[model samples]
Target: MTPSDDDRTHGGLETVTGAGCDGRDACCRLAAGVDRRRFVQGLAAGAGLLAWRAPRATVAGPFAADDAIDHFVPADKKLAADWVAGLFARGERTWYAGDDLATIGMPVGGVAAGQVYLTGDGRLVYWDVFNSNHNTGYGAVNYQAGRKPTDVVSEGTFTAATAVDQGAAIQVTVHGRTVARTLDGRGFARVRFCGEYPVGRVEYADDALPVAVALEAYSPFIPLCAADSSLPATVLKYTLKNGGDAAAQVTIGAWLQNAVLNDAGPELAGQAERRNRVVQEDRFTAVVGSARPLETAQEKRREPIVIADFEGDGYGQWRVEGEAFGDGPVEGTLEHQQAVSGYQGRRLVNSFQGGDDPQGKLVSPEFVIERPWIGFLIGGGGFADKTCVNLVIDGKPVRTATGKNAELLEVRNWDVAELAGKRARIEIVDAQSGPWGHVNVDQIELRDDPKTDAAIPLRRRRDFGTMAVAVLGGDASAAASIPDGDALEELFAALRGEPVASAEKPLGENLRGAVGRTIELQPGAEATVTFVVAWHMPHNYRENRWVGNYYGKRLASAVDVAAYVAKNFDRLDAETYAWLETYYDS
Candidate 1:
């Protein structure tokens, strides 16, 4: 059987021989049945090599014919042609400049770990490692706009804006003059990029700058070793050569954004409490960034009055209909369902007994709404009224809510203050079928506390993760600040060799910011500045599944990852370069 076009493009098998036939016999039969020249043409076309045509020649091997041109090609010419084509493809991996730059973006993260693209112009872009599907244009905006805590379920729109600019850039100062153009290929006379799989290199040349700058970016990638290869970090090495005759003093500064928790919904984008601070641990210095919860006044609360804990062996009083709710409350996640969380005790109301095909409803006994709030843990389908929990008062639903299409239950509170002292019954409905067609509910309570409550500590409402930028050598001075108008200008000034004081506090909250490092160098000498961007995002969710991350288990935080990488940078870089050397030699 011939493989499909998609299979060919993705390196799938080319052909499968019929049963009971040896490969050589099938090949011989195929060669005998078709004209030699036509077969070659067909083979080329099938291999997606239509641009290159085979030379005119008779079939050359035991099946050679004398009907065509006298030219005789080798029997293994096809294999040789494939090898030559591969070499040509590899040779095409040289520097890409100008128009070719647009095509130079490649993923540089570990397998199954999140990744950021290294663009041709030497900037890191398209950060998708956050475990959430972010919008293509604005990396800060999540595609699922209503997935965040406190967000109302709604469709999201794409904005014509770029991702949260990390300001991941480098600037050089020669003598006392600051170069206007950064190393990201803007305004440079000669800017070229070359991507060799895991490694990407960009070269910048300009007459205005006294030194030529080259930047190599990559994450740790070791063949046959998934553990070492999958570290959540990107290593950037900058090499500067002073080619000027006179002694020229140079200052090199690098900057990066505190992009932790940047993947927020559009409504909450401006409310993220991003924080950045500089930390010195052991011999390494790093700028650590994280997202803190927004500050709000704590409300006075009273103990919740338990309405239904769902801890009993069966539904004692609730009336259950259809096969979806089964005979009683489920012990946990149902068969074939993702892990269920945020539920109290061992059992919860799960309407997925026979998968999503079954539809049913669980009606609670009538109870008095004595408190100002009715809190419950809910998850699953976001079908609104079709698949939701409703507070039925006077035979009508006074309050209703559906899950946000998640398996992880979240605490939701209905403000029943106006309906206080009224009689109501809870109805958990699952009328929809197919994907996310079921519903999960647990720990319904009547409480004066308007906020949602849970038996176990639920996932934090605010995104809390850390990303750090560490300078390899201890000689460089580092600083981190919120990227306000004046702060950015100060950073640029520092990059231009201006004397600036490092932030005394070195800590900022509730703001977007950048971290920078500065270094000084003298002419007639070559120096290399290396920066490591490490992230520790332990929490990752797909739909409602909490997948977590591989690197999160190994390192406690981004600082730890940065420190580990810094301590082993020599070995890692050496092994990577050795592999590159072997590849080129082969």
Candidate 2:
């Protein structure tokens, strides 16, 4: 397996991995809300190398490769949009058009009509969380005839706000790829009938990412619509005024119901499932580096286990609920590059979710808002920062999650389908200043799902009668190398209430109070040195690097990688090979 950008090598065999586009590294160290970043001048220099730039792959447009939609509607007229084709609303619209449409338009009534989408059914349309103007409603009267568009974007025809009272329509259009609405003297002209579709106009800037849609009143850059709004209903009920020669084979799944927006919903439970899918690689390439394999790796060289594929535009939002611990500016992140402590010099551009308005936008799918909090600590160190997470959905933040001193906490709110067209920026900025600095984010998630509830972090377990053993390694041979013979004997003897061997040897820096030392097999060495290894999911996976690989490799004073593992006895057990699917060459 190739070392994907997200790949974070632990010892030798296991590498951390996760979803998201830019970096695939499974961020375990850089906890949620807060991420640690170091300046990597060398990386910046290499990235600047024009010669090193690999040839970018040119993909054929949807039209050239596989044309699916067959029904044709004229382009030069109002388009009859298929059902459930909604705009992330804030006076917004975004039509995914290839170079196929010649023109596109939609008949909008007034500011109220310009909603997230024309809700065919009106059941007090709601947003579970991650407030973005979503859920088109039919109950709200679309146009008041002559009124300005509430969330007006772009100054095109239908360009200005329509007049009030004279009864006119708002014009929607797609000129080339630019989106423009109509505005005239007699209020704007609009069409409102039983059921018609609006033609989608598409454009791309920032690369080939689509920009505007016809029926959409605003861009996906729609603001977070407070689900608890006091304003008049802005129900977007669009009828297909006209359909030129355009084809649409859109599919509207079961009508949007008030999905399970609680903490224990499906999306959250399935969070770890994604890690199961991401097959990571140990780039045996970069010699023992300063940063821990990009923070952490859950499954090493793993292949995807789930089969069903899913996609969407802005539904992939994440929210984590846990308490933040530690005093004095404890750092965090969603997913981050795991660099050693203070290994600064080269700065990797990191996008932080902390700090207010770093001049950033609430991505189409989710609205990002984080508040700093305070919490009590255990066993001393200092006070811990706490946070309650809420994402904007349908223009409102849904769930409230809190966390404590946890790095790279997991958020499972995103379903497989919600991950479509989603992107995230993970950067470590200066934490001294305001929100613009590097704020720690314990967990980052694609928030809008019913399952975000159960995806909480693992709490320490106290009850223990027996222990299991397992190994974490790409190959069984390497895992077999751990000295477990003597350790195993001692553990069994103790369980039977007997004095066992291998109980009083010295512990390595990474080893801590783990089982004890193993007898050596000198030249005439015929000793079975039994050692016990524990295979915790992501945490134990992190330990593999310290004990198995980094024992004598990394600098001292670093994360006594092994000792950290020994500290969490409950989270440890005999090492076990991850029964993950195999990864084939991409």
Candidate 3:
């Protein structure tokens, strides 16, 4: 049989392929967060073949083809976002901004970070850190409201007090007077919430050191409440320059604390199951999740597997929960690029109105897992940094399926042969707290065959198990021994004018909190340390199948970036690093 058509084209280093449809197709859907006008201007500026003085509207030519834009911009070059949505709490009203968080209004009522969605009534729906509504991957959730820690901290040679708010503390001084962070020292510079959902940028700068130092943070914003939205995520971009005659060592530090899945502090042994551990040094991706307790259900015997389908005005034997909706059972599809075909007849969907805080679940009736295949079509989009179709066996999520850029009807079939003779159920989930936090599902079928003819080949599903970080010059032992709890404190303290002491106590999981690496920057010289955060999620079909694919390709994408950086660390300049950091669409 021919290889299944996954509706994708493979192009490695020479020509990168984005998560969207084949780039060659003019009909391919545009990415959710790209600006066409800005793209055109960039092209003209780069080529220098077009006149820049002419107005954009009047200057149309060969490159104006709608499909032409996709050819020029690769997926890796797209404006990446991590947050689903953000707001500046000002006065009595909460003003909405695009991914950039470029809110011009004055913020009030203080900032509290967490996954939040603004409703039609102007009220905000929030799930504080530890709340499992539909988002994952962030621990310190107070950043959304521009909240800062309540302690004094030092970054490099700069010592500053934390803001008593949710957003980051950004203080910029030009000349002699303070120019930015004018709003009560909140350090909020911009909050743009539109276009490719760059999320928003929060900035803090100071002239305390011989060199001017600035910190700009851009959070990812998933469009339309996508579960794929990066939670508690802020890509902190730093800028430092030396103007003094003597060279100096510069240090930078930030506080990142995980509340242990909000399971009531870090002392509990139960925190073990819910523990968040950084998997690697240099490059790292923390595995933060709570596992479901084990439970068993008697296996029902069945010869030829009975099929379950949703057709006409019926949801079949499925029980729906959360915010799922369908007319006359589950029917029809909404406009997303083009008309999405319903599975066979009817389809179930959430966020029909494209509302925010879109979250819900669809559970199927019990059935014997006598076959090696479970097939279905899933389509939907959000900031969806983590949206997924979770296959819950017995009671735990045994497997997960995910798509990108609002992909329509991504066909998938899991190898469930090991579960044969076992009883199971499927949980189609769409728990997104941001905009477009919805899911689309159709044509779910159980088959004895593995659907080898499907678009995505089964054999290509193995994990690479490859992610590593490279540290330059540093005391490896000292760097490794830092404890997570006191790591940030110690680093900040060192920068805050205290002597850098070696921890007398041995290192432990608390090491996750410690900065993975610390390097001394000599006067007029800057140092950068890079590492990979990699975790290979055990295939869901295994016995311990509680891990979800919410991060899906998110962590893997980081792995890819980390790998690139590791290989090209010496060659990568600040300009290239900045481009790659923002280029990532995760």
Candidate 4:
């Protein structure tokens, strides 16, 4: 039963040869070339039911065919899931919010109306504008570079002007902010600029040279609707006109402090293992946040059931890539106190570090996805710790877990009920270069049920929606916040290992902080800095958290957010496209 080429490739859902068969036909096709008894035995074996004496159907939940919400549940869930999965696969973090701000329709999720901070140079220094259903904190706030990288603009001057709606976009104006005499008694060079919101961009110019400098700073994470929730990726783009005769050498850098801000204070900023570690990847510079505990009040004890403690695997339960028997330039080794210290116990550890060239993977055999949670305990650090553990179901990456804690093992888990009743695979990938690049794994667990405890975090609840936006910044040795322009300059230099001539003080004396990066642009060359923030929703917002009168208000707010997205979807789509058309080609 071979399928036609068109039938197999036409629709996005590629069905197996007999997948489209009717119920009776499916049974008949499945039974073909085999006896009924053998087929039944095979099904039993596949479902891990060979030990059971009798067959039984798994009962999941209640259902009402006539109820409107119940009727729409399956369709809505599938639509949302498919949409999210599709966007994630394409490396897109926002919905159909066109490419640019010229987009005609109202944008849905990206940046909302709230308090926005503008740098003296008109750059969007910080913004706390998104709408959050939760009551505690405001939506999301990110400072440019998490701190200032004044070295990027030290040679020139830029001042903030005015913010206005320029018919097609929201433009924040900036002009020359500094005036000083050099040895020859001439004013410092100045540039005119306009920073566009909703577009996540800034455009500036310096036109006195044979090769002029035309800079356009932008981030593609700008959306017409609410952010993607799971991965709120924002990339600030800078295009420099290095087309001039003389090549200009510039340093691009950022100081990052990626901390989860709830209502918690200094603790969140204190426990950072790698405070603004400069991460240089092949394509982009990024700062990863790790060891960020969900609970600031009291540490939650994690006692996950161990699935693979590497105690003994004589049967080869794991698949090793890049080499055989865990030995090579790129391989996973069964280590017993080799590079690091003691293994979790006498059990051998699955240590992975494929040299700087080849990427290594340690994959597990198939397992049932009926469990409510899946996670692993991992610890590693050094020149590179980009190793990531993935949850793959039916050949798709449903969730990912990573570790930046070079010192201690941390518990990382992800919900997997979406793939319940299915078979899934666990894959650990280490496809990066640099020192301390290896990852150590001990207990790999698939939790059977949620933990029962008093004062559970809102995130642990099966129904409450949870999302996070991580802002990456430069290398800050400690938690620091800056306000004045002069201090911002010293902070960048300090991050770059240069000595500060004057006052070296904490940017802010509180718990708030950020991490960042820097980009050096030749006269005509351009660079874009981006980050992705993510969210998870189970349609349990009103079901889990809100119960009484509070639930009513929350439900109303949810409706408003949903309505806003729906109403502006079409308009934002057009507006985004229009804005993209101008910048897309450039």
TM-score: which candidate is best?
1
Separately for all candidates shown, the number of backbone clashes (residues 3 or more apart, or on different chains) is: 0, 151, 72, 75
> Which of candidates 3 and 4 is the stronger one according to TM-score?
3
Candidate 3 TM-score to native? 0.30
In model 2, what is the error at residue 520, expressed in angstroms?
Answer: 87
Candidate 1 deviation (Cα RMSD)? 11.8
Q: Per-model C-alpha lDDT, please?
A: 0.64, 0.21, 0.36, 0.35
User: Which residue runs of candidate 1 sit more than 4 Å off their true CA positions?
Assistant: 1-93, 133-162, 264-272, 299-463, 486-488, 493-524, 542-545
Task: Tell me the lDDT of model 3 at 373.
Answer: 69
The lDDT, on a scale of 0 to 1, for candidate 4 is 0.35
Per-residue lDDT of model 4, residues 1-586, tens digit only:
1111132211111223454445333222221122233334445656333322122122122444654465655442223333234323422111111122121111212332222332323233322322223222122321222323121111022212112110000111113222111100011133232333334322333243222222222222324433421112223333333454444433332332322222112112222221122233333232332222232234433455566777663416777776322542212333332344323554444444323344567788988875666655555532222466777877887777554324344455565667778887877766654544556666677665332222334333332332222222323222233233333443343444532211222211212122334343454564433332322232232423532222222223222332323344345335555566544322
Name model 2 segments beyond 4 Å from true. Answer: 1-269, 272-432, 436-438, 441-586
Candidate 1 lDDT over residue span 38-70, tens digit each? 344456656434322233232223334653345
Query: lDDT for model 3, on a 0 to 1 scale?
Result: 0.36
Off by over 4 Å in 4: 1-305, 313-315, 324-343, 348-359, 381-386, 405-407, 448-586
Which candidate order results from sorting by lDDT in descending order? 1, 3, 4, 2
**Cα miss at 347, model 3 (Å)?**
31
